[model samples]
Target: MVQRLPLDAFFQRETTHPHKRYMVQPQVGGQIEELSWAQVGNQARRAAAWLRAQELEPGSRIAIISKNCAHWIIADLAIWMAGHVSVPLYPNLTAESVRQILEHSESVLAFIGKLDDWPAMSGGVPEGVPTVGLPLRPAGRFDSLWSDLQAFEPISDNPQPAADQLATIIYTSGTTGMPKGVMHTFANFGYTGSQAVELFDVGADDRVLSYLPLCHVAERMFVQMVSIYAGQSIFFAESLDTFVHDIRRARPTVFFGVPRIWGKFQMGVFSKMPPKKLDRLLKIPFLGRVMARKVLAGLGLDAVRYAMSGGAPVPDALVDWYQRLGLEILEVYGMTENCGYSHVGRPGSRKSGWIGQSNPGVDVRISEQGEVQVRSGSVTQGYYKQPQLTAETITEDGFLCTGDKGEQDGDGYLRLTGRIKEIFKTSKGKYVAPAPIENRLAAHSEIEQVCVVGDGLPQPIALCVLSEAGRKELRESLQGSLVELLERINDSLDKHERLRALIVIDDVWAVENGFLTPTLKIKRAVIEGVYGPRFHEWMEYGTLVHWHDEI
Candidate 1:
């Protein structure tokens, strides 16, 4: 049996292991920076000492606001080392939302990184709390993290936190209200890390590109934890714009991405060589191998040994398209409450349209209502402060009410249908899960963002926002091509689930517009309200076919 270990032990273990590379960061405009296990551990120790000097009580909540960086990991380890809980905030969160999270968590201190407007965003820091800014620029004000580390002695003694003690509190946006803090423990993270190492064959030889927000549980668990446990080197991408450049520079052995990023990669490849050219190349056996290598290398995916996609449902077509290029895009299923992964598609065990089998030590079952329920050591104990919500979500029996509707096959592969709350009922009383249908429509290389809505209506409809490349693709296609694409989508759906109409919009749905969460998850209710009336007008006037349909 695996014993429960404290979070800091992972780092200490790596420090003692000779030849272990702890971290690597691909600088935006400079050379690749590497850190050994000893170096990272020493930095984390100094950070812990600094936290101790602040005089905060053990288990005090501390917040981190920044993009993915080396300092972010150092700060996180320090927080755990000092027997405190870490709260990571998304870089793009609004001032109001940031204030709410800090206030809700009762955070005592905050560590900030480079920002566009520091003073304005710093206003979110509660009164009487100290704010330390991370100076990306050498001359910036406030005590620099590197400078502080140089001044303080490294804290060596490890204070072991109980297995049940809270480790981290990750906030996730809810459908109807403010985000809730999902409280996890040392056991939750440690066990999940071990399980991932075993399942993915993660080892010191693996290299990971850490670009996604550490605030998100998916990245925190997979990229961060897997690296620490397996002694893999993690290279941070400077930003989204430099993602491709960084990926090529790192040549990572493991890659994890959201569906949107994966879809963009596919679009990037198709843009260089159109489908006709690709189809023709496939017919030539020797030429196909030559062409595939050239294309994969050009896209910076040539060295990626394993690619996984999560955070949202991925379209089957997108997975197949990548698989054709010798890239097996494994679809993983889990959430913030489950420490990011409960099920993952394994090599030689991948099945289309399924999220794969449950990870070891995880128990997953489909309820009579089709809601997916999971019981695992990695599962959160409860919500931070909402007892009622916790009770409703996690039962006394220890199963977590996943809130996602799904089904299990005889072989134990799980296929997600939709969210229990997001499913809509038609006027004919037929319940429709928009996720599968929406994923199918969005699978077309052109679509970017899509929302499916038809509650209390005769049939469901889809509101789509085409990508820049998508709009260009539509423009180049013949009028008959557009009709054929729509017909093809319709054929994939059942009669009741077929989209009544499609409305393509030029505007993007984003957090700034109140149409998306900070994590880029669509706020479906908000979008429905904004576009509901317009959709009705188009349907009544038969103006839906117009490219510039007001609705």
Candidate 2:
């Protein structure tokens, strides 16, 4: 069965259910604002009219700089309606990073909205590119305003972009070097959006929170494309302070989060009820369900039927913890190249390591050298303007060189071992995969983030960051728990893979600090570069566990 294009499906919603509430936005001063399908269409058409009046060449690249909000989606639709391509930027990027992307994509115009730090980010807009200030933006930022654009008459005719035409160029939040523009066609989103609607069983009644960066592929596909296909209502989060209230008010049925987000949710529960006490109570048959529901309801996740974790590998123990509460966190494995339509865990997939089965159209295989490769309609055309690099990435047979090594079971379940580039040889002539080891170490409630590196060393040592639980505990107590965690993990591994020391650092590995990507994955190369010189000093220390601050 051939599905209609994404815009056509959305137009159906705009014409048929014009009055249906499609976007629920939270405003300042504790007020709520809503835009029905008709309202959304009106604004998008008005913006489209304004864009068309500019007389720019067809398929011009327009950029959007904003946090997740209703206007972000409206601006995207307007870009499409005006027969142009959209380039979405991560809202929290630095000025230099922002300018690099805008100048690289050569965006003709930019729409700004919903930011915490416009003053710092404003200089990134190149001098020649025109800017439109979207609603909910910092005041006096743009030469033109989105609200004023509505004065123009709405476009009378509906415009449909061709199936294979370029729709969006999503930039990669790179773990190394400059970000690459991943060009995707409308057909890419349409196929994934249609498949996602079927996979999630979403409909108009389904509610979702739009809190993750809208520029991200996972959020773009789940929140934006899925909503367009299923006609789901999207709720926007106002800020960090009101997140709990916003989710409670929305009561989303379909929830998606990265591993860090899932960890934060777990920490919220632990903040109220200690994990030890909660674990004991969960074993009590009659009271377990009651406590689970109570905890979930407090976090506004009681109504969540489908909870997805993606972008980074979720720790197996974290998944089990939620499983004990009768909530299964389905781990999804995908990349920006595939538009996030790769593989997913179903309801009954309560396994420890596997990332579940492949999606219907995606063919997953372990290459001869052990890299995980994928081929599907959802894959990107190639990296924009870098044909040589694109040739190096995509195989002759069309599979994307995922750069990940993995093993597959008989039933097609896949377990990622590590990145091919991440597996490093030690001085003792042993190769170690840090991802699995790090996943095991992160199970401890005290260790929020862990990275294992031992290149050209006798044995790999773990660099750790304290979780909230770890931070509140006495320093001596924190040391003992991590020691026990270290010994437990080492007992299950080869002697060569055993960690030499656990070094807890005082610094935060944040995006602002250049240690983490926007999606919260640690940049191993950067981390190693900063700490590699200190490894010998750390390994020769007296104790098995060392706090860097103490030294």
Candidate 3:
């Protein structure tokens, strides 16, 4: 029989490898701090002891608001060791959104770690609740500092939680509705994290860059749980401005990015090398290989043996472009409900637009309504305090209904068509799926991000944010290149799916702008809510590509 060890079991076992460095944190001004496994374990123990002294109940809820940092992981482990459920809030959330999550979760205490916007985030925490500040950057005035806790006597024995015990209450950053807290057990994380390490062949020698939000399940698994499971050394990115410099110093062997980051990388490349010249240079064999190596090295991805992208569907053309530069960007398909252990595109997967085969021990099937349904040990127990929502999300047959519409190929690779709720019917009574069309349109280097919206209109329209290349083209050619690109896209799409016009917007979508979620997914409903009323005016303009103000 398989033993169900507690999640903190990894920390206990670290005594066997006490001297091994587990985390490398880069500070400002190029300073570096390395912590051994034993040091991390001791900090975690002291943290747990500190929590225990507070007299909170074993299952009390604790919130963590911070960027990706070594102390973030320490706090998470400490929460579990204290037998408390952790609730992670995104550092980029507005004060109101943060208040809503904290109030809803009934969090007893919060740990404030590294933050970019503390004044806004501090306003969200309830006035009476106690707070602890992490080592590097604190969100607000803390009752105690994480460093001060190290002086306390470490807990002699850690709380040995059962496998099925609640580990975390992860709130989904919904685009439209209020965010819901999804509950997952320690067993759920252990099963999925182990499977991922095995599938990706993560070892103690592997190095990883922790720059993504640890609050998100994808980064939580890839950076925190996987690092603990495999005893890998984790590197923390200091800040956005120093991300490239930090990565260069770490030289991580495994890396993961959202589609938006990959898109930005492509734009950065184009800014240095014009597309036409780069295309010409790539045609020459030996020179092309050398150029690719130099590019990857400059981006600090030269040592990356495994790279994956999730949170949004990366355009097929973007994946192809990276592969040409000798970096294969594998696609990941999963959600917060399943601990993010779903279908993953393996290395060298040639099939375009597919998210690859099902992960080991995961069962996936397409329902009659075209929704992707999955059943796995890693699936969450349910949404916290929302049984009706949980029942609606998970079927009676034990499958979690992934809201995404998808189809499985003969080779077992899963190809997502569009979101079921995102499919809209036009005034002509025809249904259109925007993802495929958007995917094709995103192939154009000028287009940074595109959203297709037309709920009750004659047809759908494209709301596009342009890259620097696109901005230059617009200034020089009056949207001439963009118009041609849209014409080509229309030729390939069905009549209903064809865009009425390409409406160019000047503002870039960002978390602070309320255009993107913390995970960097485009907020479709939010976008539609802002632009839906102008569809008729845009259609009547009778231009193939129009500016946003034209309405």
Best by TM-score: 2
Structural similarity to truth (TM-score) of each candidate: 0.94, 0.98, 0.97
Tens digit per residue, CA lDDT, model 1, 1-551: 66446455565565567446767765546767777877777777888888888788889999988878887888888899888999998877778888999999999888887454555566677787677765352224444455675478998687778888898899986545788999999889888888888888888888888887889898898888887777788888876777788888778888999898888787787777787788689668889877777777877888888899987888888888777777898888889999976988988678878889998999987889999999999889899899999999998889999999999999999999999999999888998999988887777767778888888777787778776667775453633554566678778888988777777766778766788776567888998887777766655545223453443
**Model 1 poorest ten-residue lDDT run:** 135-144
Q: lDDT for model 1, on a 0 to 1 scale?
A: 0.80
- Whole-model lDDT, candidate 2? 0.91
List clashing residue pairs in candidate 1: none
lDDT per residue as tens, model 2, 238-279: 998889999999999999999888898899889888888999
Residue ranges of candidate 1 with Cα displaced over 4 Å: 4-8, 26-31, 116-120, 137-146, 474-479, 541-545, 548-551
What do the candidate models score in CA lDDT, each in turn? 0.80, 0.91, 0.86
Regions more than 4 Å wrong, model 2:
none
Name the 10 consecutive residues with the lowest summed lDDT in model 2.
Answer: 135-144
189 Cα displacement, candidate 3 (Å) = 0.4
Arrange candidates, best lDDT first.
2, 3, 1
